[model samples]
Target: MRAASVLEADEGRLPVVASEPQSASGLATRLELLRNTLRPTPHVPLAMEGMNLFAKLEYVNPVGSIKDRAAYWILKRAAERGEIRDETTVIESSSGNFAAALAAFTRLVGLRFIPVIDPNISGAYESFLRRICPTVVKVEKRDDTGGFLKTRLQMVKHLCATTPNAYWTNQYGNLDAVEAHYELTAAEICADFESLDSVFIGVSTAGTIAGVSRRLKERYPKVRIIAVDTEGSVIFGGTPRKRHIPGVGSSIVPQLLSHAKIDDVVSIHESDTVEACRALLRTHGLFVGGSSGTAFAAIKRYASRMAVSNRPTVLFLCADRGTAYLDTVFDPAWATRLE
Candidate 1:
């Protein structure tokens, strides 16, 4: 069977481009198109001392998260490799954004998608998945690591083994996930800002940090790559506790993470995430997710420690929008429960 040509797809098709080009002039203001359209997310500047703080609002992607890039890159590569045809089913484990992204993109290419999620999955995200995805596997149990992430992966393994013509993106270890951010997200940041001194990114599957950090290091060797993780996440040599935030932490260490590329590590608490989220909304009018709050907290911590002369242009990667976290991060009552 001849594989689908990426560029010459039918009208109202999916995966038009593997990734959006690194040019602001290429962005379209129109909506009412396919949900899988990959465009340049905005970079909103913020007020801070010493350093110039800029927030990369990745929530504006077609699926309203940065994972749109990663999911598209993986699927595009799968198509290029002849791994996905008209009838292939793609299965993967995710917390939220990645699942929603894959669901949107898979529908574009006429493929089936199943996302194995956990109990901590955001209410908004779950509803989004239900609307777009045909089947969503909810993993209620936790693994020996005391987190549902491993359990979710286990379920994915079983499904892939039993289902014929099933393909697991295995995003936790997928290098393509890293490549997506490197070629697109990082390139956009560099293009938008000619001189950047540091970048703070949240780590979960570690794809974003791994790719972006490597790219920045190659170009600006002195640029600080700070890794922000929640307290419960084991990614940054922390004890595996329970993390409330979905996008910024991990129970299991991701294969894509390169510790050598990171210059600093900041572990944020759930309360800090909440406080930062509220602050962003009140002060900057940026309604972002818990992980974005985590990144904001990390930005303050990094800024406070640096001397005035040492301060530089700092960028924070906001993982997703507050809409997906409305039930918890934005709700006063629900947020109190976590406290």
Candidate 2:
């Protein structure tokens, strides 16, 4: 069932709201399109009952994470441009979510996936990918020296160079992720919501910043797109330092970030992130990952900046269940370690 009509002052320029599907194949098509059209899932915050805070539940996507959107977009775009075919094996390096998503989706479409993972990731995450992907390559995260994720990716590049047919999604630095978010997420925010005060999001490679910020600016030029980075991330001009928050806190600003005109970059502490993840689990039944926990912390901080009314403020849970983070974020001793 669809809702009633909505037209704004500059409505026609906006693309039609993406239509939902009713069947399995139809659902696949819808999800594929969703990579180019993510919608805001509305929800009310407990702290603010009368004043609703819309947290876009991105974890609902098929692959148990929002990275599924980027996967679909980049893959389809690749198909369109003759970059990949059915026989072409898919490849990428990821902490877990992106690789897991690629593995699942490649299986669904009868394609092969190669996941390049680092030793720093959780053991369970490694096991999960091994089950999904046809081939799993682990890179050393050594204290002294190891090629790690970066080195593993270079290895894949070398393999692809020699191999006859392989498709590298290259999501870490891929502009496709940025373009995917731009097409789907940012546009949805402008169309569905009216006059959003601020949006809180965790930054990884800054693709979300470029994508989400671009569309928000197109709609409400004054809309506040505060790019949230973890304590160790270089995104907020911080010195590169180690942090517990995963899927975020990169050592350098992503290449895609150059195109985005970000309003403000705020860095949050790891302690706040761990606490917020617990709060989400206890209160909302949302066991989100470290980056989402970081996002939640920023949402609280950004919410203070929002007008104390029913005005909608938005944030996102980028991936699904903290089952992946159980050993760390969900563990008491882990919290104690951070504390």
Q: How close is candidate 1 to the true structure, as a TM-score?
A: 0.87
- TM-scores vs. true structure, each candidate: 0.87, 0.81
Residue pairs clashing, model 2: 287-322
Give the per-residue lDDT of model 1 (tens digit) for 1-339: 234344433433333332222111111111113323677778988988787889999988877898888988887766666666555689999988899888877765556789999988887778777766667899898787678998898899999999888999989888888888888888888788878888889888999998899889987878888899998789878888866778988998889886238988999888889989999999999999988999998888767666558668888988888887777888888778763
lDDT by candidate, in order shown: 0.80, 0.68
lDDT of 2 at 35: 48
TM-score of 2: 0.81
**Candidate 2 local lDDT, residue 327:** 87
Off by more than 4 A, model 2: 1-46, 49-51, 142-149, 303-314
- Report the poorest 10 consecutive residues by lDDT, candidate 2: 7-16
How many steric clashes between backbone atoms does each model show?
Answer: 0, 1
